[model samples]
Target: MARGKPDLAALETRIGRDFADKALLRWALTHVSAAAQRPDSYERLEFLGDRVLGLAVAHMLFEAFPDDSEGELSRRLAALVRKETCAEVAELWGVGPYIRLGEGEAQTGGRKKRAILGDICEAIIGAAFLDGGAAAAEAIVRAAFGPKMHEAGRSLRDAKTALQEWAQARRLAPPRYRLASRSGPDHAPSFELAVEIEGFEPAVGAGSSKRAAEQAAAAAFMAREGVTE
Candidate 1:
C-alpha cells in the first residue's frame, strides 16, 4: 500500500460503476514504483486493459464509420489509443489524484506525467473488466472515449504532420528532431527525442519507439508554441 489510499468509491461514482472486487480498483491505481515490494501493481492490469480498450475502440470505429476504409479506421484507432489521448481521458475522469505513486515518483510530479496517468487509466479499465466482465470495460471505454472517437474521425492529424504544417505556414524552417537518450531494456526500450525550431527553445518527449518519440516531441513543441491542429 502507498501512503494515502485513493477514494475508490468516488472513482466508481465518476465512472458510473461499482467494483465487485474493490481490490482490483486498488491494484489498478498502484504503480510499479509504489508496488515494488508488493506482488500487485498496475502493470499486469495495464497489459490486459490495453487489449480490452483495443477491442472496444475497434468495434466502435467499425460501427461508427461504415464508409471508412480499413486504413483510415486504423489511423483513427491509433490516434485514439495513443498515450496522449489516454492521458486526456484520465484527466477527464480525475484519475491523477487517485493514482498511488512511490514517494520519489510523487516528489517528481508523477501524478501529472502523461505516461503514468495513461497507464493507470488502462489499469482502471482492466480492473473494471476483471470485476464486472467485458461489458463493464466497454461501458467505461465508450463513455470516456466516445466523444474523442467522434472528434478524431472528423479531423485528426499526427503530431509530426501538424507541426510541419505549422512551421511551413509561418515560412519557418522545418523543425529538427534529435535523439536525446535511450533507456529501459532492449526488449522494451524507451526513447527520448528533442525537437528544435529556429527561434524557440527545444522540447523533449519520450515514447516506446523513435517515431512515437518524435511525434511526442513535436506535440510538446506545438503545445509550447501554442500551435493547435
Candidate 2:
C-alpha cells in the first residue's frame, strides 16, 4: 500500500548523505499523528533535529553576511529557521509523502500542513545529525534554507512579506490592516491603519495608501517585536 519505500534513496540523494541505517532516515519523516496509526514516530527525531537545525541556520546566518549587524542577523536567522520556511523545505524534499499519518490527520490534509511538514523537516535534519554529525546536519539544512537567508536579508525593508510569513507560520490568516483614523483627503490623504495580528495586539501605522499603511504597520510590529530591518 505504501508503494516502494517512499523512495528514501531519492531523498537521501537530495540530502547528499547515504544512510547506513536506513531506518533512521525513514523515522525522520514519521509524525506522531501517523505514528499513532503505525509504529514509528518522529517526535524524538524532531526533538533532536530542532537543535540541529537551529544551530546550522544560526551558523549560516553568522557566516553568510559578514557585515550584518546583530539585530539584522537575528532577523535573517528567524526568516530561515521559521516554521514556514522549514515547511517549504519539507515539501521540496517530499517528506510529506513518506510520513505515516493517522486517519484524521491524513484525512484532513495533514501532509500539506505547514506545522507538520516543518516538524518533519526538523526531524530529518536531526536524523542526519545523529547518523553523521553536526557537519552532516548542517549540510542538509544549509542546502535547504541557505538561499532564504540571502533573500530575507535583501528584503529587510519589505515588512509586508515579513508579516505574511509570520502570520502564516502561526497557522493564522494574514494580518488585517484597517484605517483606525484618517485625516485630510483628496490632495493629501493621510491614513492611520491598525494592523492587527491575530491573537496579538494591534500596531498602528500611517502612510499615503492602504497598502503603504499596512506595510508601515508590519514594520512597526517587527520593530516592537525586536526584529530588525
Segments in model 1 whose C-alpha atoms lie over 4 Å from true places:
1-6, 152-157, 160-179, 182-191, 194-212, 218-229
Error of 2 at 201 (Å): 9.2
Q: How accurate is candidate 2 locally (lDDT)?
A: 0.75
lDDT of candidates 1 onward, in order: 0.84, 0.75
Model 1: per-residue Cα lDDT at residue 55: 94
Candidate 1 yields a Cα-based lDDT of: 0.84
The TM-scores of all predictions, comma-separated, are 0.74, 0.65
Local accuracy of candidate 2 as per-residue lDDT tens digits, 1-229: 2656467787788767898788898787766655644346887888889888888887988888889999887777666775667778888887767777666667667777766787788888888888888998888888888877656334543587777777787698888887798775332346789888767888988865465577679889888877553
Task: Locate the minimum summed-lDDT window of 10 residues in model 2.
Answer: 149-158
Candidate 2 off by > 4 Å: 1-5, 36-40, 152-229
Q: Write the per-residue lDDT of candidate 1 for residues 33-128, one digit (tens) a residue.
A: 788554587989999999999999999889999999988888788788876788888898888888877776776677887777888888888999
Clashing pairs in 2: 34-100, 34-101
Clashes of 2: 2
